[model samples]
Target: MYPFLRMVKELIKFRNAPAMRVGDIHISEHRCWPWDIDLWAELNNGRTLTLYDLGRIPLAQRAGLVSVMRKNGWGMTMAGVSVRYRRRIRTFEKIEMHSRAVCWDDKFLYLEQSMWKKNGECANHALYRSAITDASGIVAPERVLSAMGHSAQSPEPADWIKRWIEADAARPWPPMQDKR
Candidate 1:
């Protein structure tokens, strides 16, 4: 189930917060509720991804992208993601989630986000590729940035992210298998 209520709360809490640049980080705190736990008694992988939305959307809001999207009738969607879970988050544990836009290319925007425990350990992290779309199709990142009142020029994406992009591009679009 979608955590719409939690997302709304995040939006309201940061409504009056200052706007941020693309390079600025957006920080938020969250707890691992009982419902968020998997059978292993830790935060479920799917839930972690969903919770990451709580950070990413607010980050977009702070960067003024959300408003621009709304005015233009554009929508955002995840194109791809790479995540690493390094530690387990127990129920009732507090986590500090940090999110920021790493950079953008011709087609998509890259974002890096992490979940840090209260003890200063990184529980998990992920790199996301997101696309902004409208009635036509996927909108170029350059156009999206321009709509957000920024220059079209984008900072260089990190080497690792670039490599990941290349690797993903090389992958087959659809899988193949034969019945045994």
Candidate 2:
């Protein structure tokens, strides 16, 4: 089930946060709840991804991206992701989430986020490709930035992210048919 209550709590917690630039980092604290654990008694991989949202939404809010979306009737969606889980996160363990926008391409924005343990070890990290959409289709990142009252000029995406995008582009859309 979606943690709508938690969502509201986080939203309210960061509501008054100062606006941030695209590359500015947003730090958030969270705990691994019992319900968030899996059979092995660690934070579930799926749950980890969902928990990332708690960090990202606040990032968008602080960056004023949410305001742009609201004003322009635009929406944001996850187009792709590459995540690495480095360590186990035990139940009730506290984590610090760090999130920031890396850069933007013609049609997508790239973001990087990480969950860190109190000992300074990284538990997980992810690179995300997000698209802004409206009634027509994907909106250009420059346009989205403009709507957010930001400069149209965008920094180039990281080489690794650019490689991933290229790899994704080469993949077959419908996939191979099963030879049953």
Best by lDDT: 1
lDDT of 1: 0.94
User: How many clashes (backbone N, Cα, C below 3 Å) per candidate?
Assistant: 0, 0
Root-mean-square deviation of every model: 1.0, 1.1
| lDDT by residue for model 2 (1-180), tens | 776778789899999988899889999999999999999999999998899999999999999999889988999999989999999999999999999999888889988999999999999999999999999999999988887878847777778888988999899988999999
* Clashing residue pairs in candidate 2 (N, C-alpha, C atoms within 3 angstroms): none
Worst 10 residues of 1 by lDDT: 171-180
Q: Write the per-residue lDDT of candidate 1 for residues 32-68, one digit (tens) a residue.
A: 9999999988999999999999999999998999999
lDDT of 1 at 132: 98
lDDT of 1 at 158: 80
Candidate 2 stretches with Cα past 4 Å from truth are none
Q: Highest TM-score among the candidates is held by which one?
A: 1
